[model samples]
Target: MGIYKILKTAILSLFFIVTVFSCKPKKAQNENLLLSKKNQLKKAFRYPNYLNKNYILGKFDYMNSNNFVIVPKDLSNKKIYIRKEVLVAFLKMQTAAKEDGISFKIISGTRSFAHQKRIWDYKWNSKYKDLPPLERVQKILLFSAMPTTSRHHWGTDIDLNNLTNSYFTKGKGLNEYNWLLKNASKFGFYQPYASKKEGRTGYEEEKWHWSYKPLSQLYLKYYNEHISIEDITGFDGSKYSKNLQIINKYVHGINSELK
Candidate 1:
């Protein structure tokens, strides 16, 4: 072959090889970028109530995520889970209460669906078992919640120093109660179930139950919008949820200040 033609052929082959290799990496890089975005979208959809029902229904495990923190021993009678933001506010409130010479403990915090179910089942098989189903449920509802319907599931409500209403009626309990009534709201907390004499429905007066409104209020909004009586199954007497207007008279029944 002529020298010029031979050199021309070599140059053409070199250009072809360089072009093919360069095109391959560009194609591969494009594919990798697309895959990365898809994975990111999946992760984004996983958070902030993915199913909208899971978190509110107590299906998610806050213990397994950074979204919750353990309640400190001094603040609670037992190790309990609470939302991180709620804990921060409570600590501030605790300090303020201490300065006023009043003190309290957290008797209960987050309760998962399974944990609540155990409570419900125990009561279901208690002496009330002999009573009619509706009556039995009503009796339980006086102070207890029906599993998924509980605000405790949200990690934003805590049962305070005492459980009995009489405890907060006078003496030290009364002092503590008065303090909370006067100052708890400054920390984004509020009593959920107030005295029936005030015309509030749902559970009986529980002076100890305080909710972190900033977060629980949002969760409550989600629960009302996403949850229905049909979703409140897996327990005895669940069929009566609709008849009892559990969503309205119960879930929606809160201190008007909370609304």
Candidate 2:
């Protein structure tokens, strides 16, 4: 026990296991770009806005690891999850859009009022029971999200890489939507269905969604100060959740500097 005190207790137990995982959060940057502790526990996790109806059809689809996380790296093999600060600004904007080639890939993220009530009861009783619950809620708001005003039940949204918009346009989905419109707001991300060419309303024009606008602007200002529409009912077209204006046209639709 004395060869220089057993090599100084094995170099202080390998410097206490590399200073406890060098205080964690890899996608690295203490390469001294700093920021770790699992990206500061992914900037301190906090997802909520289940907007009650027994926390949206029973504990927001098994409470995705209790307020979501998952995305260690599986751009879409499956699990995905989201808000650990939107997977650390989407893996730092998918590793700075793969050094110019752009490859960001999450197919969709977060959704649970019992997974948007089985996608609003498979488009309301199998593809719009023959339209007219206010034009099948305007053709399921031209794409979806009626289950408790979904911003994917607020895990700071994301649907990226290509869910259509003709996969962005042309080459590498028009260079991944022009490298997410010139570097996704320096990494906080936006694009909540922007172009109606210019007008914007309810939905329609979701060029592969995105939104981590610094924690989906506090869950869209706490679903506009504590959600209503009778806390957005249970399922099956949810009686068009109180003749839907859906909190000023789909919960402040978006893009206007993310409300």
Candidate 3:
């Protein structure tokens, strides 16, 4: 072919490549996968008023109900929320468990910073106020996140079926927990407080709490690299945060597999 024809063919080939590439789904970008540690931190911190969802502390994830979907009343029984994708995964898990004569419920799901504070303060005022500030803090952290730091803020962590180990020891709770242990991961769920063969610290072993790993991993990374004890506040005994070294001992002090 002549030079013009050759150049024309080359241009057409380039155009075709560009068009096809553009038409293809934009992976990573459109999928919202946070694969890079650095980029993950940047994106986590960049959300506007992100702190507002869980208070100004680095404990809560940003909320856009559009990113969340209301769960069916049968699954949750009470009004509850979770990340939209997480809701989908839970539905699938629920369906699978139903096949095995196991059913599940969301004992607790998404919680905003305000909701967490209410839980924290209620405990502080009613149950543990007589204890030393440090002891009180520890008592709460045994099962609760300080106001701004609860994983529930992410809408990916869930409290399921029952919160007690005894409940999971026998009967339907046993079946449910077993079903989850065997199957939740298939739907992207994980227990965040199971004890190791030897021992572990931080929160007591909560047999009920499960996190959606894909997004919670990113959130945990944000907490590890960005949040500090000093950054937590708006609750009783938070001033003891630094004294307690909550940043490492509590916030990061979770099931190692979770991290």
Q: Which stretches of candidate 2 lie over 4 Å from their true place?
A: 1-82, 103-131, 149-151, 159-164, 172-207, 210-237, 240-259
Query: Which candidate ranks first by TM-score, i.e. highest?
Result: 1
lDDT of 3 by residue, 1-259 (tens): 6999999999999999998888665764655554576688866765334424333343444444567777888888688888888888888999988899988889788888788899999889988989987888888888888876778877888888877889998988888888888998898998887864546656788889999998788777766666666568777788987877776766666766678
lDDT of each: 0.89, 0.74, 0.78
lDDT of model number 3: 0.78
Could you tell me every candidate's TM-score relative to the true structure?
Answer: 0.80, 0.30, 0.75
TM-score of candidate 2 against the unseen true structure: 0.30
lDDT of 1 by residue, 42-93 (tens): 7785336443687899988878978889998888888899989989999999
Steric clash pairs (candidate 1): none
lDDT of 2 by residue, 1-259 (tens): 5799999999999999998787774435564355456677867875554444444323455444565777655587567677687887788888888888678778778776677778777887778889877777678778788777778776678787667798688987888898888889899888888787777677888878988887777667766766777776766656665666776877786779888
Regions of candidate 1 where Cα sits further than 4 Å from its true position: 1-51
Residue 47, candidate 1: Cα error in Å is 9.2
